[model samples]
Target chain A: MSFPYSEKVMEYFSHPKNVGEIEDADAVATEGSPACGDMVKLYLKINPETKSIEDIKFKSYGCASNIATASIITELSKNKTIEEAKKLTWKKASETLGGLPPAKVHCAVLAVDALRTAIENYEHKMGLLKEKKSTDTNIIEKRLKRVINPLTGLEVLKVNFVKKIDLDDGIITITVNLDSDHPFANNIREEIVERLEPLWDIKKVYVIFNDENERH
Target chain B: MEKRNVYLDNNATTRTDERVVEHMNHYHLNDYAVASSQFSHTPGIKAKDGIEKARQIIAEKISALNNEIVFTSGSAESNNLALKGIALANRAAKRNRIVVSKIEHFSVLDSAKRLGKEGYDIAFVDVDGEGFIDIDHLKNLVNDETLLVSIIHGNHEIGTVQDLHSISEIVHKKGAYFHTDATYSFLQIPVDVKKYGIDLMTVSSDKIHGPKGVGALYVSEDVIIEKITDGGFQEFNLRGGTENVSGIAGFGKACEIFSEEDVERIKYLRNDLYEQFKSGLKGVQLNGSSDFSRRIPNNLNLSFDYIEGESVVLHLDMRGISVITGSACFSRALQASHILLAMGFSHERAHGSIRFSPSKYTLKEDIDYTVHHVKEVVTKLRKLSPLVEQQ
Candidate 1:
């Protein structure tokens, strides 16, 4: 287990700082699907003057990987401009944490996704983007309807598979309730992304399978 | 600091006793002949003597006749044989039905499920909150059409021991056969199939510190139970295979060595550990019967809410303490303890359940260390849990 992750990942996990919520933060974003059992919520206080992230913190509901990555991402984003923070990829998050297991690499992906979501929310709230309602939720819903889940063989909609769908600042986050019994979740995610690919206003698309792992 | 091994999963499998190993080795090296061999060679007679001796001891321990004990691979196969073999034999009787408790082990449950394909109407009896069998429900389920009523003597995960005498009476009133799986309770508790009115019973050697790959099914005299395998006329033409003479010898040695006093001492240790665990821990709820006499003396199952049981088990494992969890994440069970769920526990409680079964070899120090490490693990995981933060 020690070699599965670097000392840095374990360190952040054991002594995770900025581990609470920002009560009245300017921007907030919760990411990760409940189906896979890992979730992270990012809270931010963006200084309007410099358009930089003045304060950042997180609340994570996952294993050591999720907690450490969320803690590291928050620390890495603090004091950085909104645009600069938005540029940080999941790879950079893992690189900063020394390294992460390939399977657990999603923990870092979730961290950066949460950060970008917060940034997107911040820009929309600041009136940088006008009212942000171009995302017709039904288009994604209709696209999801036609998809017959590869494993269950039933239509995804028939099983009540859609867990969550959040639209904020033209950024769409679709959380599908994919149990371990469900197959080809990647294909479902890909189909959803492809269906939304034509929409220019939707800057970012997140199709997450169940994020929660151990306990719901 | 690294911790030494503290194995508390004795119900899963006990460490083979040294005497059992020695007895097995004796048969393997010196008396390595087919037990059923008719040739009058000394080695062949020795093998045959070993098998017969082991069978007599096992039968005596359970208060059965020597010829009644039919040897099989282990309890699972014995369970299948007792259920499917009996069902197959009695299908001509036109009863075409079976009754089993919801808390019966998967071996019995799965066997009954397989029997369902053969047109046997399988009825699951309910259990109370403490995992006790509901007698009224059992009375309602048993009728003229019921061919066999199989109930486990003790629950494995929750450690709930059912009263076989009472259950046997109810099944007998309806003229149906009563089968009890005594795999967990036979050696740890005083299980007398005749005294309890049990028509058939399943017992495992490995669960009682004996060699693996050996078990027995006590078929009451004149039950006329059918055999699944068709081979040489061994095991009185019931279990048709060459006997595992070495393993059976080892099993007999284990049974003889495990005395009545051993039961009392193990029960004392179990209660002592339970007292400390209940007093030492917070938000820890015991899963099975509160009465120690009504549960397996070697088992203590507990649940801690908010945090997953798998987390606690894994953390303890990292500290060199082996245990099992009812958590869906750790088990073949897609979610929570089915035993707990049957007893009407919330999904969270089932997800947070852990079963710790200590043997006679489990030292008081090992129990103390286990409790200390368990508290530490639960506290840490609760802190890390998002569900806790949400609360």
Candidate 2:
């Protein structure tokens, strides 16, 4: 496949802006995923007065797209406020580059992730950052769902509803439905029984609607 | 940047030389004729002469008799013929057992594994961290039931040379036949069948700049081989099929090139490249032994921590420079190398391994260009790595 790298991407990589070390840099962030086989170490110099980025530099160990993404991100953040750079997403980096291979879209994501991670490090060190955002808050709770577990090779019926998690209460009840002759009814019953025993008191466990169990 | 592309992937396959190309072209265009023609015509005479020249050069390179070297498709075929052919002939069904090393190329390993499933017991001797075979472990494994011992000459990945003489002595002590897959080490490292007491040897042409799809097996004059297939009379009534004449011609030229440069000059270039690369990249760890005396100079396998080999290889590829992750045969698979795993490398570190092999044609400028690009790409990639935390 012909990888058409953007001219600016190549320009920054070949003659990178702020390529070397910053002696008095505000923060340095380094992170790598052993699974992905790439690493990013970001160095930033922020103006103490304006809380804006005076310089940004990065060194990356990965593919062509990864190197290009990092180079462009550093160049884009120079002279920009921390909030502006924090707002820059992977989408912005992808659009800046002509495009990347589907497998390599992660390279752009990593570049932005590294920038945000570095900024987070800077904010935490300065004692100005609040608690980091939790990823689960935006998740919409659905009623119930069934899916296959790729790792365990088992069918699991998952309920997305949140019950009152009463640890002090003696007993807790969870309602689920099995109206038809579901093949994995017994399997799901066993799975749920195995999961709930340790956390909650179960004086009597009963399957209210399991026509599938009776038919089988 | 210069437009000239470098090919250091000779271990994958050597480029067909100009002289060999001319010889093949001349035979195909003007002097082409079937070698099976008994009556000597002008075309037949040229074909016969070409085949003889190839055989003679190959024999001389390995110090074997002219009749001992039988041409086959390649090392895979040669190994199959050597191991299976010997086992089927001498070993009883219940007594079938083959001894091999863990670091052997798949041509030997898979061939043994296939036979093992057919009620043949297979014993794989392990290698140390430096890619050296544990002779004592091999000795403990070999017994009277052992049909053959197949050890590779030089490791294709780490480039550590095996002590064939010692290994051959151990197998013979146990009254078992010895075989060495000298595919990667034939021309680069010295080999002597008489000195090592090798009963059977397998080698390929492409590893030494010859045409692909042509190889030879050195079966001892006294050793017996069972026919693996039935066909017309070819390869001394053992492997029966029409021979590849052009590939054989190319193979001969490649052997002659090796004989001409018997003391290889590429070792110095390889060392220079190794030193330059080692000093340029900080936090780089050499995979095998640092002793040049024990390893092949042309092959430098290194691990750059916190970076995946595939990514490093891609960065180098983008710069128009070529290298390898390990053996080219297993390049497509993104798993830890089995050899490295057997030698006790964790999966994470093993996946980060890369091999740098240079041929006689690789220049100083090539190494310089590689070092420059490697530093840049590694520094950049390290930033993105979550495992390699900023200190």
Number of the top-ranking candidate, with DockQ as the measure: 2
Interface RMSD of 1: 7.9
Cα lDDT over the full model 2: 0.69
**Tens-place lDDT digits, model 1, residues B316-352:** 8768899998865565434556788789876556767
DockQ score, prediction 1:
0.12
Residue B381, model 2: Cα distance from true site in angstroms: 2.5
Whole-model alpha-carbon lDDT for candidate 1: 0.80
* Model 2: interface root-mean-square deviation in Å: 9.9
The best candidate by lDDT is: 1
* lDDT by residue (tens digit), candidate 2, B1-391: 5744666676667777777788777778876786655567877777867877898888887788877888889998999998889878876544567999998888889889988887788999988988899878998899887778899888788888888999999899878889999888787777788778999999889887788999999987878887675686776777887677788888898888764342355677667767776777776777765677777656778877766676667667778878776421124453457887778765445656777777767777877777777788777666554345347
CA error at residue B48 for candidate 2, angstroms? 2.6
| Candidate 1 local lDDT, A1-216, one digit each (tens) | 344668888788767878777788888776653233455778899998999899998876555677789999988889999989989988888998888877678789988977886787677567666455555777567645644443333466678676777778867787777744333355456446644543546666777777543211
In model 1, what are the clashing residue pairs, if there are any?
A33-A211, A35-A210, A36-A210, A36-A211, A36-A212, A37-A211, A37-A212, A37-A213, A38-A211, A38-A212
